[model samples]
Target: MPSLATRHEGHVLVIEMQRPLLKNALSRALQHELVSAWQELEGNDDLWIAVLHGVGGVFSVGHDVPELARGEGDEADPEPVTGLFPLELSRPVIAAVEGPCYGLGFELALACDLRIAAEGARFGFPDQHLFTSHKVASVLLPHMASLGIGLDLLFTGKTLDARRAEEVRLVNKIVPEGQALAEGVAAARDMAQRFGSAEAFQKQAIWGFPGLPLSTALNLARRM
Candidate 1:
């Protein structure tokens, strides 16, 4: 079966991770497919936003341990793996998370411009407790939460429930279980319609504001 799927609902592209048996693990194939989906979002004028989701009851369990343990998944990717780092796309993407979102799964959601998680969802990085991880979370966690919070999660490899994720701003909003997709899609649709004129500019400006000094950021915004 295909590892990923994409469909459009009006201007919102819905990207689904389809490897339910593996808890939607990030296989190399899936990662490549995701890049294609993002590229489609970037190139298609009719597509204004994207909503990323997982199948089954779970979001993802990060890397497919079994595949890696077997010394597989070594194929070099043409582009940077999508969820492991913040992807640069002209259009905004929202994560609709449910169940466990761990390791790269958490990082993927963090990469999104916004996240809407189901009430029973979980978030964490297990690589600290196991082998070395992709470590992209090191760059993103601090951006989303306090240094202490980021360190605590990174060092302990512990999991956070949706409520705690919300408190730490890991997720933008929490919805009833099974409603994250609806909420995410609705939010994407609203943003697409209301901000389509300058959506790309707004995304670039907001994401760029983080690491820059206030003066530099202001100048950058002026240029944008």
Candidate 2:
């Protein structure tokens, strides 16, 4: 079976991580599938938005350590820019998170435009314990939450439950366990039907104009 699967509910494309046995670990094969899925979504004009979720109760346990230990795949070949990561998507993508979302999993959610985490969801960056750093989380976490909160998670490798995550603005909404996917799909459909292309453009402005000078950013916004 494929590690990733994509289906459509009206205009919303639902991308599910299917590797439940491994807690939906992001292996190189899965990353390649994700890239292909994003490329398909980008090319399909009928698809308005996307929702990312995982099978089983867990969202993702992060990277496949065993696979890495075996030296099976090239970690840097495909790269994040190839749509293996969330930030590359121009269209809006919502993350429906449940169970543990750590390391690469946490970074995936951080890259999404919106996040709806279940009550039992856990978010953290445990990679620090392994003396590793998360590139996306390091830059995006502070922007999503706060400098202090971001630093705390990175330095301590501690997890925050959904409620705490919501308090820090890391989660846009928190639903009961097993309801995140439904809520996320509903939200995506709402935005797809009501907002149309405006959501995409707004996301572009929010993510793209961040590091630019005030005048340059404003100029770009005006053009958009």
In order of appearance, the predictions have TM-scores of 0.91, 0.91
Q: Give the per-residue Cα lDDT of candidate 2 at 180.
A: 96
What is candidate 2's lDDT per residue for 1-224, written digit by digit as tens?
Answer: 68999998888889999999999988888888988888878888888789999989899988777776675348633233256676766688999998999888888888888999999999997665445457888898888899999999988989999999999999999999999999999999899878776345466667887768999989997998
Kindly give the stretch of ten consecutive residues in candidate 2 with the minimal lDDT sum.
72-81
Q: What Cα-based lDDT does every candidate model obtain?
A: 0.81, 0.85
TM-score of model 1 (CA atoms): 0.91
Report the Cα RMSD per candidate: 2.5, 2.3
Residue 128, model 1: lDDT of 60
Off by over 4 Å in 2: 73-81, 127-129, 197-201, 213-215
Error of 2 at 173 (Å): 0.4
- The candidate maximizing lDDT is 2
Candidate 1 ranges with C-alpha deviation above 4 Å:
73-86, 127-129, 197-201
